[model samples]
Target: MLEQKGNLFILSGPSGVGKGTVLDALLKDYNDICYSISTTTREPRKGEVDGEDYFFASEDEFKSLVKKDEFLEWAKVHNNYYGTPKKYVDKTLEAGQDVILEIDIQGAKQVRDKFDGGIFIFLAPPSLKELESRINKRGTETKDAIATRLENANKELEEKKNYDYLVVNDQVEDAIKKIEAIIIAERCRL
Candidate 1:
């Protein structure tokens, strides 16, 4: 039997759609799947670790990486640059370990264009009203920032058809179960 090549799973959605929260729960149960850590220019939130949560870089440093073409895909969203390193992802996938990229909608589109095979899953909120409520409860964004996110979310939801799966994040546990099922089914595919 030939050794199976690793699969790429892209989980993306609009901001404030609970993508981060759902990912936190989903990743805790997996030891084999490699969660791709992205590099970004955004400041770390309260308890986010530098290397674990994200490789936080300065604007100049991020620009240098872009110029070097080190990133598989990178995008400027909400005034911060977020990118995935091509080297790390290539190495992990070649080793036969699955990779899950928890990226935003824009980055996912870029990655989809550059890569041939990947399971694109879009995490969605139950409704726009609920999404706004969740963002407000986070207390992380300013009023203006929240507005911008809401505006962007409206547009992103329109792109859901492009994804292979849409997991609605109305309840965290339920959403996690759905994603887990997707992973299990994908792994068993002949």
Candidate 2:
């Protein structure tokens, strides 16, 4: 068998764009893929266990990791620092597993700058209005946060050209198939 080339899949989209839902479905069905667990400075949410939802860290610990160059990509959003742990990804890829990093566009860009051949997939909403509505419908974000996300969505959409694949997620199953196709095509390229 040919040696499997490690694929670092950077999946990014605006908040409330169903990135999490698509990722959860993909994880449920894709055995060869592993989700990247990011380290965060934010406190764990209710029912979210440490090392599962995230590797929760103190602000000092996160800063220490930053200084030690331990992250593949790190960023600050709304005063919280979130970053991908480099060692886990390296080990997983070395073991020939496909690693998926469901990160933001900014973090994705940082990964792109560092890793030469990883695949980038951008999930886009069918329309800006629809995207905003989805964000609003989630009811997790405050009105101000929703507005901020809508504003950010416009900028994020402009980054489609930077990605290797752009999939509009108007339909969940269709989007999954598209993502599955991309993964298959990438595997063939190896």
Candidate 3:
């Protein structure tokens, strides 16, 4: 049998859609796959490790990276800048370990443009009302921030047709199975 070449998988969705939760469950069992840790200009939240959760950098240092064009995709969100460092992702792929990126909708679009052949998955809520409910349930954001996320969620939903797959996150296990199946099917394609 031939050795399999790795493929990049981009997971994108609006806030409060449970994207992280689903990925967390999947990662628990699939530890061998590489997950791209993004770089961020924002300060680490409570209990967030600088290098593990994200490559925490000062705005100046992030700007230097931007100037050098070192990011596969970067964007400013909620007054903080975030970007996917190119080197780690490239190295992971070269090592034949598939790389998974959990990014925002815009960042996903940017990666899709550059990596047109990569697998693009868009996760969606069961309904707009349910999404609002989920955001409100989190209790992590201010009123204004929640509003901003809902607005962005609407916009993100508009781009769902652009992705290679759409998985509605109504149930956690079913969504995971769907995503796992998609990954398995994609691996067979190449």
Question: Model 2, range 1-190, lDDT digits (tens) per residue?
Answer: 8667578888987767899899999888877788988999998889998878899999999999999989989999899999999987888898888899888888888888877788999999999999988877778888898888888899889999989999999999888899988988898883
Weakest lDDT window of 10 consecutive positions for candidate 1: 25-34
Give the TM-score ranking, best first: 2, 3, 1
- Clashing residue pairs found in predicted model 1: none
lDDT of 1 by residue, 1-106 (tens): 6777888999999988888888888989656678998899999999999988899999999999999988879988889998998887888888888899988888
RMSD from true fold, candidate 3: 2.4
Q: Model 3: what TM-score?
A: 0.86
TM-score of each: 0.84, 0.88, 0.86
Better of 2 and 3 by TM-score: 2
Stretches off by above 4 angstroms in model 1 are 40-61, 76-80, 142-144
Instruction: Count the clashes in each prediction.
Output: 0, 0, 0
lDDT of each: 0.90, 0.88, 0.87
| Rank by lDDT (best first) | 1, 2, 3
Model 2: pairs clashing at backbone N, Cα or C within 3 Å: none
